[model samples]
Target chain A: MIVGDRKPMDEILEMLEPYENILILGCGTCVTVCLSGGEREAAILAGQLRIWGKKEGKNLNIMEHTIQRQCEKEWVDEMRGHVEKADVVLSLACGVGVQLVAEMYEEKAIYPGLNTTFMGYPVVHGTWLENCRGCGNCVLAHTGGVCPITRCAKSLLNGPCGGSQDGKCEISKDTECAWQVIYERLKKKDQLDWMNSYQPPRDWSTAGDGGPRKSVKIEEVID
Target chain B: MEADEATSTSEVPEEFRPRIVAYCCNYCAYAAADLAGSMRLSYPPDVKVIRLPCSGKVEISYLLKALEEGADGVMVAGCMEGDCHFMEGNFRAKRKVRHAKRLLEEIGFDSQRLEMFNLSSAMAGRFAEIILEMTERIKKLGPTPLRKGVKD
Candidate 1:
């Protein structure tokens, strides 16, 4: 999932200053899974903002609602009625979810409440670490399930860069060498042979060709 | 463990009884605690029970906020491992508890302070025992530094 974390409260407040009626839209999927923009988070942020709004004596109407998946058009479309009534939308979803909201409602303003980190998992409760760059291509097959692109300090496709010292990355003592982790993981799985093959630099087209992008999205195409 | 650092709540509990918080699944753990009440089983009142529809509904931040407010110890009580009013509620709750334990430890709070338990709704005695155990553990640890003046 595309991992994200909330932006500073001041930033959010700044964005909402122009609008009178606001909606704090949340996602129930990936961002929710990573504990970023979810129903619970939406409620909490709403409560907090309301308290802040009251202290400032500003007449702010902040409504909180969560969708099943903000990335999906169908889910976003459900809010058309709600969206039309609000002056601006404060999306708690990831970056994609924000874009989708923007796409869904062209006339209204949409703002992001999260800083859309990298794709990661919950290392533990409330803790998230970046794992995937979502370069549009996945290379998990060669790296023994670990993605050096995201986990490695250098995003090295090859084995540990010489910066590793005593199994730790030179970038930081606390961080483990991604290549070493791959080595051990591959060894455990008896897939070290996969590492012997060489790979060239990753293609950037899938990452940032920097143009209007479109996907086939076969499932969404109805007869 | 990461949640503590992430939520920035761990540092808030610098001292005191370390307000203990528990999220109890209304179907199981809450009922168990009620059973303890009926049975007259005694446990410390420092721990506050926040009833949840299911442990699954309790988010990581919910627990973090509790700890930030000086909850010295936290626990999530759910239905038995195999039985949940909402399938996998306890399972997810357990995962959350484990993650919370790690987060608390990462923030300098003892990981033991956050715990997860699975019990049948009928097992009230077990609930009292768990509460007593958690209270004793927190008492030994003393007040959480953050809780010394947490806003609540």
Candidate 2:
């Protein structure tokens, strides 16, 4: 899932200084799963903001709302009434959700409450690790399912670099060399021959190189 | 004027008593509190214990809510490391406690007001000690300024 972390409270408070009626909007999808932006988080932030405002002698009218998915137009539309009531909208969603909300409400001011980190999964209860870069290419078939693009420090396509030492990457002892993992897995599967083949340079066009990427299904469009 | 001055000199300042909310795991800290009671151990009466099924169930929102609702201090008491009945609930709770403490500090409150304690159900004496320690620390810090009508 797309992972994100809430922006620092100081920055959020500063952005909210000029606004009195604030709407803290939360997303119910990926941001919620990552425990960054959810209904509970929205409420907590609202409460904290109120306390801070009271301390500063600034009276604030804060409202909390969480929609199904902010990235989708339908979900963004559902929050129109709340947006109208708010002087400013503090979006506690991923970057995509924040942008979508901004696009949907061009006349209203919107501020992101979270820093969208990466596409990753939680390794443990509260720890998340980045596992994919979304390069718009799948190279796992040739590398024994290990992502060299993200896991490797150099994004090596062929084999291990000189920095790989005893299965560990030079970046840190905690990080395993992606090539070493691929080599070991391929060796176990008796498919070591795949390692002998050389891979060409990766294409950048499909990976949002030229501009923002979009996907559309012509048949599914109602119009 | 002499009589008025004498009466004013005799007046004593009211002691500051902190209101603390402790979220205790039922398997460990809650049971320890009960044990402390059964053993007749003395601790501060300022702490109000709210028992939960596990320490991991203590959410950050709950901690913040306690402070927002007039709690001067908050604590999460869980089992010792690696001894949780739910395997890693205590560990998870510890991380959440640390995060919540940071949040509290950012919100202009004393981070020391929130703490995490690890103890076993059998350690009744230790439970009493922890309560006293927390109370003394809070006394030194004085009442929370976030409390309504409190002066800095």
Candidate 3:
């Protein structure tokens, strides 16, 4: 799931000072699973805003609602009535959801309540660690299912870098060396020969470095 | 329902009783609470215990919700480190508790109101001590500013 963290309440309060009627929008998908911008989080944020507003005598009117997936146009459309009533929409979704809402409702003011951190899943209940960098290319086949692009500090392609000491990354003793993990896994699978092969340079064009990327399926689209 | 109404109105005490919510893991802390009961240890009645299958099941939202719903303080009691029934559930809960504390501090609340404790089922005495210690600490902190009738 896409992992994110709520922005500090101070910043959110500041952004909301200009608006009297605020809508706290939540996404029911990725952000919900990561425990960042879910329905419960949206409601809590609304409660917090109300407390702050009362303290400051702002007379803020806040409404809380959650959609199945804020990234989809249909789901966003379902919130049209509430959106139109709100002076400003405080989106608790990821960055994608915020932008999508802004694009869909061009005249309305949209603000992000969360700082979209990374594409990852919860390792346990509350701890989320990044696993994918969305580099547009996947090389997990040769690397024993461990992603160097996201795990390795330097994103080294071939093997362990000089900074790898005692199977830990040089960036921090807490981080395990990605290449070391790959090596151990490959050794167990008797695929150690894969390590000797040098991978070619990654294609930058397929990645988002060029520009905004899009995927289209003509068969699924209807005019 | 009648009893609840009586407690809320006619039976209301002049003294302020801090409302506390304790999320205890069923595998360890919950068992310890039961053991404390069997041993006949007396702890504060201010605390309300909610048991979960594992400490990791306790989410930050639940802790925040407790405060939002008028809890003066919230505590997470889990298994000792390296002793979680589900391997790293206690470690995960610790991280979440730390994160929740930071969030509370950011929102201008006393971060000490939220805490995490580690113990085994055998430590029934320690469990009772924790409840008393937390109750006293919260009494000093007074009602949460977010609580109704409490002014900033």
lDDT of each: 0.79, 0.87, 0.86
List clashing residue pairs in candidate 3. Answer: none
Off by over 4 Å in 1: A210-213, A217-223, B1-152
Candidate 3 chain B worst ten-residue window by lDDT: B1-10
Please write out the lDDT profile of model 2 over residues A157-218, one tens digit for every residue. 98799999999999999999999999999999888999999999988678777888878999
Task: Name model 2 segments beyond 4 Å from true.
Answer: B1-13, B32-43, B80-83, B119-129, B149-152
lDDT for A72 (candidate 3):
95
Interface RMSD score of each model: 9.5, 7.5, 7.4
Report the C-alpha displacement of residue A34, candidate 1, in angstroms: 1.4
Candidate numbers sorted by lDDT from highest down? 2, 3, 1
Tell me the TM-score of each prediction against the true structure.
0.61, 0.85, 0.71
Q: Ten consecutive residues with minimal summed lDDT in candidate 2 chain B?
A: B1-10
lDDT of 2 by residue, B70-129 (tens): 676789999999999999999899988988887766877567878999999999999999
- Model 3 stretches astray by more than 4 angstroms: B1-102, B110-152
User: What tier of docking accuracy does candidate 1 attain?
Assistant: incorrect
Quote the positional error of residue B109 for candidate 3 in Å: 3.2
What is the C-alpha lDDT profile of model 3 across A18-66, one tens digit per residue? 8999999999999999978999889778866765554344677889999
Model 3 chain A: which ten-residue window has the lowest total lDDT? A50-59
